[model samples]
Structure formats: C-alpha cells, structure tokens
Target: MHIRDPIHGAIEITPGERRLIDSRAMQRLRHIKQLGFAELAFPGATHSRYAHALGAMAVATRVFDAALREAPLAPAERGRMRQAVRVAVLFHDLGHPPLSHTTELALPPLGALALPEWLVDDPGRQASHEDMTLKLILDSELASVLERSLSDCALTATDLASLLTGRTPPSGAPFVAGGVDYGPVLRQIVSSELDADRMDYLLRDSLFTGVNYGKFDLDWIVQNLCHVVREESAWLALQRRAIFAFEDFLLSRYHMFMSVYFHRTSIGYEAMLRRWFEESSDAYRLPADPQAYLGCDDVELWSALRGSASEWARRIVERRAYKVVYEEHPKDPHQAPAVESALRAAGLPVIVRRSKGEVSKYFGARRGIFVRTERDVVPVESYTPLFERYAEAAVLVRIYVPPEVREEARTVVARVLS
Candidate 1:
C-alpha cells in the first residue's frame, strides 16, 4: 500500500505492513493527537502518531537498505531483522494515551494503561513502550503477518521484547550489554543514536506543528551513517556506528521542545486537561487501578468526561471546557505561594505543577531521559549530554484555575509585575 503523508510525502508499505497499519488497535492512533491540545494554540498541530509511525517505519526501511549495502546481511537474518524493525515502528505509540504525552502525568484510576502496574511506580522496573509494544504485536495482527508473509517464526515473543527494549537475547549469541546484534549491519541501522525514529519525527513534527527549527539535511544524515570499527582493550569491536546526525537530531529535539512542546500557553491548556480529569469526578468512573485505564484511548476518555458519573467531568467536558485563568513565569520560587494565595482568594480554583529539577528541593525526584548507550540504556542521562541539559534547565510551571477566577489572576500578575 502507498500513502501520501503530508509530512514525509509518499509512504510505501508491504502487505504485512499494510495489515498491521490497518489493525483496529493501530487505527486508534487517528484519534490520539501527536501534540494533544497543541492545535488549540497552533491550529496546525493536529498530527497523529499514526502518521509519525508510518514515517518512522519508512525511514527505518531506507536506513536498513543503505546499511545492508555497506555490509549485507545473510538472507535468513535480514528477513528477521526487517520484521523486527517493522514491528518496532508499528507499536511504538501503542501505549500512548489519547492526547499523547500531554496526558503523561495524569494518574489513571489504575496507573498507566501501557505497561504493567509495576513499571509505572518503579521507574527502575523495566517499563517501556517497547515492552508493551511487543506484547501488543505478538498478540495482534502483526503476529499473523509475520507468520503469513515471511513464513519465518524468528520473531518470537521474547525477540519482539528485545527489539523494542534494545536488549540482547540469551544463550544463543553472546550479545553484549546495550548493543543490538540482529546481524551486524541492520542492527547498526535501527539502533544507532541517529536512527530512523529521530529522523522521521524531526521532519514530521516540523511540518505538523508549523515549526521550521526541526528541519535539517536528511539525505546527508542517512548517507553519513558508516560503521566505526574500534579496538578496545583486547577485542576488536565491529559494532561501533558513527553518530552521523546525532548532534543534529539532539539539537532538533531541543528546538522542538522549546518551540512547540513547552510553549507556555500549550502547557496551560494541558494543565487544564489534567485538572479536569483528576479533580473532576466525571472522568473517573472506576477505582484507581491499572485495569480500569488499560486500553482506554482518547475516545473513551473524552466519552467518560462528557458522560462521567462524576460532576467534575460533566462540568468541564460539557459546560465550560475549563478555560485558562492565569499564566506567568516564576521570577522567584518563594513567591509561588503568594501567587497561589492571591488567585485562590479571588475565587478561582488553582493548581500548580513544576518541571523536574525546577526546584532544588525536588532534586533527585526528577526523572531524566534514559538512552541505550554502548555501555547502558537504562538512564538516558548517562549517555547523552543533551538530555542532562534538559533535566537541569528550569522547567515551566503551569497554574490552572477556573475561568471565573480570570480576573483575580490578572490582578495578581499585575501586582507581581508592578
């Protein structure tokens, strides 16, 4: 099947890829916005994970093709690796809730719907879209396609898990920690720092959000991804791959964060969504449990909000839609309470949420991005300097209050600025 994507242009897929894309679960992405509530601000930021995933898989295919030319894979191994990569791209967004990451912080009546309950609370516990992704695929249409098209059962349940999480399988191959070994060449293509996922999203997001900062030289980046064989200690390592577009990818991510993801008003709108769901009774019909939230996508969430047994959901989703009342930077953390006090006194219901490391007191509480490095993929913090910079940067704190309190917020901001 061929798709003419607005961001990546023409997208081609095999029959198996088409089946996976057409799956009921994968189709759920249409309602799950890539930048949830972002369109409320940008108007054009309504792209969905479905599009991004297609673009990502396309990039993966191109990268794998190029890398194989450099060091071709055996026929058997190449087929397995391709299937794994396709599965990985298809299921990457399976766990994301309706609004994508916009609803990431809101606790479902049952923790996260994506991973098992253990992974949500225990950050160290092996929690990933990859793990959940594999589970979805092995149990879904992707599994059927793998059996039908390739006729190779190499993509075992465990192999799917390993591909998504970047873990090396046991016994058969002495897979080094954090290094992928799906043959030498294809692994390099799919798992590198400057891999398909980043390449697709940067350009795709730029087009969707109407932001130009993420645009870069794509063909150049792909062409430059050559093998970097290095000898360390006694052994010669064949797995070293150049981070051809890594810096560009990192910089593009940073720009996307600043320009689109973290826009203050966008943050405020997301905060409103969070408040409506958490404080409103209508959004939560079930007890706080993972099973309740599991498989509940955007449509269900919105449906619950509109017809929730709780009064809060009815009011926000039904009547007001919860408008933003106040927004401003915290010149001094000490004054946050004062701002909160003034807004409350003025008759608006107020809630404040901060980014990690924004306050010295919450130092160790912040979760940094984890990367699968040559050494480790556990904490993305250790491998990349870019993520560390993001962690330390002062995150924006959004305060959401009832619209009736808008006058009070304006009064408080005027006083603070004066």
Candidate 2:
C-alpha cells in the first residue's frame, strides 16, 4: 500500500502491513493523537499515531539500509531484519490509551481495566500491546505474511525472543527477527541515543506542530554514520555524533514540552477531558466510551470522556475548557510539596502526581534497565549550555481555571506566574 504522508511523502508498506493497518486494532491508532492535547495549542498538531507509526517505520527502514551498508549482513539476515524493524516500529504504541499517555497516567484504574482483559489480571505480563502484538503476529493471519516477508518460518519466535532479551538473533541463526532488538547492528539503528525513531519523531512532530526546533540535518547525520568496535562489539558511530543535530533534537523536546505539549491552556483542555473520563462508569451515567467519539485512530482506551453523560465532555468538545489560574516552575527537582501547594491554591482536582522518579520507571514499572560501564554517568546537561541552563528546573505547574471563571482566572494566572 502506498501511503502518502504529509511528512514523508510516499510510504510503501507491504500487503501484510496493509492488512494489519486495516484491522480494527491498528485502525484505532488513527483516533489517538500523536501529541495528545498539543493540537489544542498548535492547531496543526493533529497528526495521529497511524502517521507516526508509518513515519517511524520509514525512518527505521532507512536506518536499516544504512546499517547494512556500513557493515554488510547476509541477504537473508537483512530481509528478516527489515521485518523485525518494520513490525517493531509499527506496533510500538499499539497499547497506548486514549489521549495517549496523558489519559494513560490519569485514568489508571480504568486505564488498567481497559487493557485487554487477558492482560489486566496477569502479573507476569509485559505491556498489553507487546503481548497482544506478539499474539496477533503469531496467531493471526499476520503470522504467515510476516514470515513470508522475512522468508523465514521461525521469525516470530526469534522476534519474540529479541524483545524479551535485548540481544538479537545469534550469528548461527539463519535470520534475524523483529523486536526492540533484532541484531546488535539493527538495534543500534532503532535504539541508541541517535537513532531513526527519534530522528523521525523530532522532524515529524516539529512539522505537525509548526516548529522548526526539532529538525536536524538528518541526511548529513545519516551520511556520517560509520561502524566502530566498542568493547569488542561492532557498533554504529557518527563522525561527530552530529552534536548540533542532537542538540536540536533535545532542545526541540524541551521546547515542545514548554510551548506545545504542556501549554497552560491545553492543560485546561485535558483537565476537562479527565473529568469527563472520571464520570464514565459512575451513575453519573454514560452510554458509551468516549473513545468512540474520537476519530478511528485513537482507540487504545475508550475515550470515555467523549462519551460521558456528564456536562464536562460536552463542555470541552464545545471548547468550554478551563483557564489557567496559576503557573509556576519549581526550582528543585524533588519538590513535591510545591506541586501540591500549587494545585491546592488553584482549587483544581487532583489526578496524578508524576515525579521524576515515577517517570524513570519503564517496561511496566518493574525496574529500570540500565547499561552500566566504566564510562562516566552521562552528564547530559554538561554537554550543552542549553541543557545546563535548565538543569535546576524541576516541575511546571498549571492551574486549570474552570470554564466558568476563565477571564477572571486569567488575571490570577498572570499574577501567580509574575
């Protein structure tokens, strides 16, 4: 299938991917916003997960080609690596809840329940999507297509193993399999600090949000990639690691958090969505999951907010969101009290308090995976004055002004920030 994406022109996906994209599960990604409430602030930032996935796959393919050129792999291995890279990128966030991560964190219990029933009760489970993805690939018709794409019958087994372990197919294996890690060489392309996923998203998000800060010289950086032996393993390295390219990527993420993703006005919009979701199952009484109200792509969690019988969803859909009553940037990274105080002062409802510590937990909050070596702890801030300038910055506070007092509340916000 030829998908003409605004960001990446023509993205040619295989028939198997086309079928997967057409599935109700994958199609739901169309309704899920790539930037969540970001479109409320940057009107153009309404791209969906469908687009991000396709774009990421395209980028991954390019990175795969680069890896092959730098250190050639067997034709059979390269074909399998392509399947693994494409599948991994395509389904990376298939389990993201409605409103993406925002609602995922906000509606934990419902979010918890909304996950496939199979995953909800299992303590031994990985991510719901990861499990479902493997299940779908192995049991569904996708299995044969993916195998055919790789020309290997055991691709699914190898792919599953790779995601489970960060290692790729053994050199003795006839082919590599798709997962977060396929082969060490392919893993470097998909992961690594400077990989295709970030490269694509930075540009893709910037383009969708009307920001230029996220773009780097992707062509130049890709060209500079070279293979180097690090600790007896071959790894891809960039000539300069394109410090400027990386600086742009990091700065873009930072600014997007400030100006786009966390815009105070949008916070008000999301709070409205949160309230709507809260009333989803209670006798406050709703007929449907709000997830139905959004476009087809955004379907990980039912947008119970959009389907709420409550006045909240109606108000928000009608653009009657809250205003920002107060704003603050905490000076210390660990200042929980400051966040609590600001929320109290604004008189906004509490949802979740995400500490840096909480944010650090990944792969379903089991524990963080760290790669330890003799190298110095990455002083990310030390590398660039830009990062150093914001090192002490901890938290950003936004007090959502209920729709009723927006104008008056705007004044309060100005004074509080001042």
Candidate No. with top lDDT: 1
Across residues 47-158, which tens digit of lDDT does each residue of candidate 1 receive?
8888888888888777665544444446666666667776666667765666777565553322233443322445444333433454455555455655564445355544
Q: Point out where model 2 deviates above 4 Å.
A: 15-24, 105-154, 157-182, 231-234, 278-306, 330-394, 406-418
RMSD of every prediction: 6.6, 6.7
TM-score of each: 0.73, 0.70
After superposing all C-alphas onto the true structure, candidate 1 shows an RMSD in angstroms of 6.6
Best by TM-score: 1
